[model samples]
Every structure is written in structure tokens, then in C-alpha cells.
Target chain A: MAKGRELKGRIKSVENTRKITRTMEMVAASKMKRATDRVAAARPYALALGDVLARLVRPDIAERFPLLRQPATTTRVALVLLTANRGLCGAFNTNLIREARARIAELEAKGATVELHVVGKKGIGFFKYLGRNLASERIDITDRPSAADAASLIDGLTDRFAKGDLDAVYVTYAKFKSALSTPPSTEQVVPVVPPATQGTPRDFLLSPNADVIVEALLPAYVRNMVYRALVETVAGEQSARRTAMKNATDNASDMLTLLKRTYNSARQAQITQEIAEIVGGASALQG
Target chain B: MAGALQVSVISPEQVLYEGTATSVTAPAFDGELGILPLHAPLMTLLGTGTLRVESSEGLKRFHVAGGFLQVVDDTVRVVTEEASLVG
Candidate 1:
């Protein structure tokens, strides 16, 4: 009876755990849908911006724009690590942290001073535990990221790059390829790599002139890039969470089935033992 | 059909409009620039102002902040970050 009761308790707890995980899985799935939609919606603007920039930006003009200026030597660099605020997602935060660590190591190996900027609570906690210094840490950003959020995040870095204060800037995040695949990756946002000019150049009318327009356009392009990374990371996080929760729920169900069967068998064994004891007492008294 | 221009107004968040329009007036950096059908290819930075899109149905207006406008082969693409419908 004691064994049966214990198994019953375990079964109840596992059922509760399964319920929670099931709820989480559904929530994550819905959020993933919306996040993926956002990633798709943001694409047209990026493509059109790239198209215009490709036509306007050339080798000579690129030299004039400070944001597009390539530093002759690698000395100082900024690594912006993007992670999720919460840690329920499996390996999402861990992968990003690992990628960032590797990136920092690579930069340090090249004799560059890396100024680490981390976003999300998970990343901040991990770096703090490691006793590493963070140039900046922000917990305000959430799954619902906006263009203003992106601008606020990257504008200062872009300004420093333009001022020649920083040699280069890199952002590490999970790139959402599909619901099944989101790989951790790093991209250099500074020294804007101009997209290869498509087709032949056309003599297009430029308002005021090319220099003024390019100056204004380059920062917008950078902002778009940051926004894209933010949205993609959110999508990846939700997808990872959904998969993790699904697996957890499945495991809980299997455990519950096994525990229930054990509990039933234990209860039946106790009943048989009681019947046998009563029958033996009657037979002994009769004899 | 020959006179109408294929227009796409895209923001960072979503595509606000994608259809044929008679003309598009965007807030260029220096000043307001208007695009009619068959306008020469042009690229210009946008300023914060009202963007007007005239079509057969009516005139659609948007409050656009920073971005650019591109015109090529009768396709007017208005790409801006801060854009919302204006009443």
C-alpha cells in the first residue's frame, strides 16, 4: 500500500508537469508564427534599400562615407551579443553565448580589444558568473522589438564607428532559417559592405547630390540590419522553446504511463496478500 | 493601364500599399518630389512629411519620416522606416 501511494503521488506530480509543458508548447507555437511573419514582412524594405544603395554606392563614393570606411588595422572592436530574456528555450541562449565566446576569442587572438555589449538577462547572468566585464548590458528589449528599439541599440555604435572611435562592430544572434533550423551566426555591421552593384549603372537624378543622400541612407541601412537580427532572434527563440516544451511534455507523459502501471500492479499485489492472509487464518482455525 | 504606375510603399514593419497608382508624391530630403508615370529613374532620401498616393479609388496618404524613394521603369517604391497612415 505504501509503495502504491508513493507511485500515485509521483503520477500526480508528473501529470501536473505535463500540463504545464503542454501549455508552454502551445504558447510558444503561436508566438513563433507571429515572429516568423514579422521576419517575412521586414524583408521587402531591406531588399529595396539594398537595391538603391547598390546603385548609389561605388568604390570612390564608399571611401567618402565614414560608416563605409574600412579601418586599415584591427585594434578596437565591439561585440554585441543578442540573447533571449528568458531561458526556457533549449540551447537557444547557450548557442548564442558559445558563438559570442568564440567570436571574442577570435578577436582577441587577432590582437584586438573587444568591447562586449550583451543583451538579455540570460547572457548578462552568464557573463557575470564568468567575472567578465561588459561594456553595456540591456534587459529592456523583449520579444516585441521595434524599429526604435533597433535604432536605440545601434545608433551609438554607428556614431562611434563614424567618428573612428571603434574599428569595427559585430553582432551575434541566431539566424532564423526555418522553424526547424536556426543557426547561431555573427555579422559585421560596421564598415557597411555595399551590395554588389547589379546590372549596369544608370544616370539617375539625385536630390541635392549623391553625397548627402548616401550619408542619410547608410545609417538607415544599418538600422534595418539590426532590426532584422532582432526579429530573427525572436523567431528562433520561440521555435526552440516550442520544440523543447514538446519534448518535455512527451517525456512527462511517458513517465506518467509507467508510474500508473506500477501503481496499479502494487495495489493488486497488496489486495492478493490480504486475501491470502485471511484464508490462511480461517483454514488454521478450522483445523 | 499604360499610364498607371506600379507602386509599392514598404516600411520596416510591413508593406502598406502595393498596387497601381496614377502618381506618388513623397517627402524628398530637400523638398517634396512628385512622380508621374514614365518618370526618369531617380533615387532620393526622404524627409519627415506627408506622402500622397493618388489612384483611381482615391488619394492615400501616409506620414513618413526617414527613408528613400526610388523611381524606375514606372515603378515607384517608397521605402521608409517611420510610416503610418494619415487621415
Candidate 2:
């Protein structure tokens, strides 16, 4: 049985914890809203670029551009991994690392060489422990990153591809599914996938011939794809944090409730014991 | 036919501009390069400077630094290192 003083002290401690969790929850919610908006705003560029890319990848342009050509061998691949700069959210980094491990194992089983361009401290830590060879690395890109950053990485990747250093390039990150669920997703960001051509791509008249247009469009395709992925990654981070903070707040509340019950029962038991002692003394005096 | 090219100026945060332009001028690595409708299929490294595009309204200028320009058919995709508009 806890004394009133002890119960009050315990409640105060729980209250302090609750306040901290509540504050975190609010911060996470604000970040989630901003991240979601950024992701949505970036989508048009991604889709429009894809449309232009689809038009560029005609049978004719495929003949001219090495990037457009389908590879005869699936021997080696490079993955640029983006993850959280920090780790407070639940299972966000875990899911991505798990996905990457499985992917690397699969590639190894197929006798395909796998290289990595690790972005964020999470990826750096994960691969460093595994002693994996990294193609390139950048850490701590959690906040908003400009298109210029994307270009620097893109230049590195494209140069390697141009020199035939890597056969394919992929980007791995957590895709923002919703507030409660962010799924780890991997997409090919390099050797840009030509958009699917269903409509009559030839219907639109080109200022230049289609060949020139195709030539001009490939890099734009890459930038948009990378930018979209980053936006989704940021959104996913916010969602994960919001979800984690909410759970924390809920857990703290439950703990407070349980503590309160224990405290009250303890309080009642002491009162009853004290009353019994006093009444028993009165009865004894009368006897 | 030659004057119209699909030029999209985009930033990571938003699609800054997307429309039909009669002519487009970009900051190419070597110098400023202009594209008319029937310009050659070209892949050029971008430089920091003014990105000029002609539309129905008049000439639109974007202050840009570094990127790449890819021209295919009627589409000109300007991937700028950094871009801001000039009034």
C-alpha cells in the first residue's frame, strides 16, 4: 500500500512523462502534414516527366541512346539506399534494412554483383556492420533536400553508367503509404525506364524531330524520379514519427491509469487498517 | 511545328512551370544554348545563368544554376541545379 505522499509523487512523475509525449505527438503531426503536402506537390513533375519519357522511348530512339537500350545481361546492379538520418520512429529503418538484406542475398544467389550508394546514417551503419562494399555514400539528408543534391548523386551514377561501371541503378526507401503504414519500396531510378506508350505518342508534333526530343528528355526523367522518391521518403519519416509518438502517448496514459488504480487501492487499504486500529482500541477501553 | 516544344521547368518541391513554349533558351555548360522547335536531339550539361522560354505571354526568364537539358521531339526537359524567376 502506498502512502498518499507516495501516490502523489508517482502521479506527478507520470504527468511529466505524459507532457513530454504529448509535445512529441504535436511536433510529429505538424511535420507529417508538411511532408504529405510536399510529396503531393512533387507528383505532377514525376508523372509529366514520365509522360515525356514514354514518348522519348520509341523504337527509333532506343536505337540511338545507350540508356534506352535493354540490357542483354542482368549481371550487376547498383542500389542507392535512402533512409532516416535519425531513429526514433518504429520499424522505419528496420523494414528498409530488412528489405535491403533480402535483396542483396537474392542478387548474390544469382551470381550478380551488387554495389551500394548509401544515403543517411542508418544505411551507413547497417552496411558498415555487414562490411559491404559501397559505391558512394552521403549521410544525414533527413530534412528537405534540393534538386541540386539529387543532381550531384545523379551525375555520379550516370557517369558510372556511361563508363559501363554499373549495369543498372536502383533507389531504395520507405514509401509513404499512410499515417500508420509506410512500406519499404525500391524503384529503378537509373537507366531511366521509358514510360509506357499506349496513346499515339506520334500525334503531338515535335518542334524538332522526335529524336531530338528523346535526347533532351532522359535526364529530366531521372531528376523527377529521384525527387519524387525523396519527397515520399520525407513523408514516410513524418508518418512514422507521428505513429510512434501517438503510441507512446497512449502507452503513457495506460501506465498512468494502472498506477492510479494501484495507488488508490493502496490508499484505501491503509485507511481501512488505520480505522480498524483506532476502533479496536476504543472497544478495548470500553471492555 | 518548329516553334513549339514541351518545356517543363521543375523544382523538387513543385512544378514551377509546364506549358508549350515557342522557343527555349537554357544555360548550357559551354554557353547559352537556344532551342527552336526543330532543334537537334541534344544532351547538354547545364550552367548557372538565365533560362529563357518564349510563350504566348512573352519571354519568361528563370535564374538557374547548373543542371542538364535534354531535347527530344517536341519536349525540352530542363533539370536545373537551382532555379528562381526574375520579374
Candidate 3:
């Protein structure tokens, strides 16, 4: 009986863990739903803004814009990598880092230098191990990031681009596809390039003037791009946590099932042995 | 400045304020600048401070931080750094 005590204790511990993992799974599920909705709600506006901005750049103003100008060298690129502030979800940060490293290598293959702008703490700590200096980053921008915060960061990126300190700006994050799937993505942030097949801009009124309107829309465009990525990253994080918890729950349940089987077999074997001993003793007494 | 000018304050997150107002006053880096209806088309970089838009009822104040201001045609668009309306 005491020999099986260790197994019993192990089972108890596992059950406790299963309870916690189950709770975590539910919590992650709720968060995943909220984050998914947030990303979806924000998309139409961002896409509309992007499309509007694509057309707003008049040919003349485009000539003077530094962001539009091509750089002499492609040696150095600035990567703005976004990851969750804390670690728990499996492979979330790892996959992002893997993509970022590949992107860096690709840029380097083009003879460009690479700089990191780590958004979350995990990225900062990871890149620091390789002796990289982050151009600029914001931490603790989880839950819902304020539009202003996104704008402020874009302002910094704009400065770097204007100064020609960076050849191009890139952002890497996990794009939320669904509750079960999110893929890591690297996107170009600046030079305001619209897809070739973009639709025409609507003829909205020029409130103050056309130039002012364009100017207003440009920064908004930048903010939209970054905020969308951030929101998507959060959603991806939640989904990853949910998936990890689900696996843990399933594994625990399997372990408990196996233990129950072993426990029954062991109990039956002990009962049979006891009966045999009692019968043998009675026969020996009668003899 | 015959009538109220249509002004919209937009951020990346959402459209903060969009309506018609008699005048718009903002805190610029050097000083405060006011925009009126049919104001000359121009653009200026905004600094940190509160922005005010006036109407017949009263003046509404919005807190804003670093961004730019632009006026084109007759519309005044303030793309603020950080914007919050007075409660």
C-alpha cells in the first residue's frame, strides 16, 4: 500500500496542475475572443486610411517627401519586432525571432546593416543578448494601446527615416488569422507604398485645405499601420496561450486515465494475492 | 469667417472629434494660433497643450500633445499628438 503512495501523491499533484491549466485555457479563450474582435473592428478603418493615403500623395509633394526617396544604400534596415511583454505561450516569441533573424539575414545579404526596435520586453531582452541596440521601442503597451502612443512611435520612425539613418523600416509580428492559427509576418512600414491594385480615394471635402488634409491623413496612416500590427500581435499571443493550455489539459487528462488503469490492475492483483494466502493458511491448518 | 468651419481631429485609433465650430484655437510651439472659417491654407507643427474650439453655446477644450496642424480649403484639421476632450 505504501509502495503506491508515491504514485498517489504524483496523481494528486497532476490533478492540481490540470485544474490550473484548465482555468488558464478558459481565460485565454475569453481573451482570445476579445482580442480577435478588437483586431477585426480596427481593420476597416486602417485599410480605408491606407487606401486614402495611397492616393493622397500628389505627384509634386511626393517628389519632395524624403520617405518616398530611395536610399543610396540598402545596407542597414531597422526592424521593429513586436512580442508579448511576458512569456508563457509556447513558441510565440520564438517564431517571431526566427522570422526576424531571417529577415535580417536577407537584408544583410543585400549588404545592409540591421537595427532592432524591440516593442515588448521579450524582444529587448532577446536582441540584447546579441549586442544589438534598439533604435527605439515602447514597453508595456499591452491590452489596448492608445492611438497617441502609436503616433509618438511613428514620429520617431519618421525622424530616423527623414535623417536617412535607416534605409527602410520593417516590422515583424504575429498576424492573427483565426482562433487556432496565427503566422509570423514581416512588413514594410514606410515609404508609403500602396499596393498597385489599390482602389481610388473617395472625394471627401477638404475641411481646412487639401494640403492640410493630406498632411493630417499621412500620420494617421502611419499610426493605423502600427496599431493594427500591435492589435494583431496581442490577438496572436492570446491564441497561442489558448492552444498551449489546451494541449496541457489534454496531456494531463491522458496521464490521469493511464494512472487510473494502472491503479485498478494493481488493486486487483493485491486482492487475488490476499485470497490465495488466506486459502493456503487454512489448508495448512487442516493438515 | 462667415460661419462655423468644419474641423476633424483624427488619430490612428479613432476619429476623436468631428463637427462644425465657429473657431479653432490650438497651442503651437511658439504661441497659440486660431483658425477661422475660410482661413488661409497653411500647415504648422503642433506642440503640447490644450486645443479649444468655440461655438455659439460655449468653448470646448481638448487636451493635445505633439502632432501637426493643417488648414486647407476651409477645413481645419488638427492631427494631434495626444488628444483628450474636457469632461
lDDT tens per residue, model 1, A247-285? 999999999888988888888899999999999999999
User: What ranking emerges by DockQ with the best candidate at the front?
Assistant: 1, 2, 3
Q: Compute each candidate's TM-score over C-alphas.
A: 0.96, 0.81, 0.76
TM-score of chain A of each: 0.96, 0.92, 0.91
Candidate 1 residue pairs in clash (backbone atoms < 3 Å): none
Superposition TM-score, candidate 3 onto the true structure: 0.76
lDDT of each: 0.92, 0.76, 0.76
Best candidate (score: lDDT): 1
Which structure is stronger by TM-score: 1 or 2? 1
Q: Tell me how far the alpha carbon of residue A74 in candidate 3 is from the true structure, in angstroms, after superposition.
A: 1.9
**lDDT per residue as tens, model 2, A1-287:** 43777877888898898898789779878988988888887776666556656755667657577566566676778888888887877888888888877887887798889888888888789889988888788874657766666767676776677567777888888887776777998888767678786555444434345665566567666766777777778788878877887888898899889889988888888989999999999999999
Off by over 4 Å in 3: A58-60, A131-133, A136-138, A195-209, B1-11, B14-87
RMSD of 1: 1.4
Error of 1 at A248 (Å): 0.6
Sort candidate 2 into its docking category. acceptable
DockQ for every model comes to 0.84, 0.23, 0.13
**How far is each candidate from the true structure, as Cα RMSD in Å?**
1.4, 4.9, 5.5
Q: What is the TM-score of chain A in candidate 1?
A: 0.96
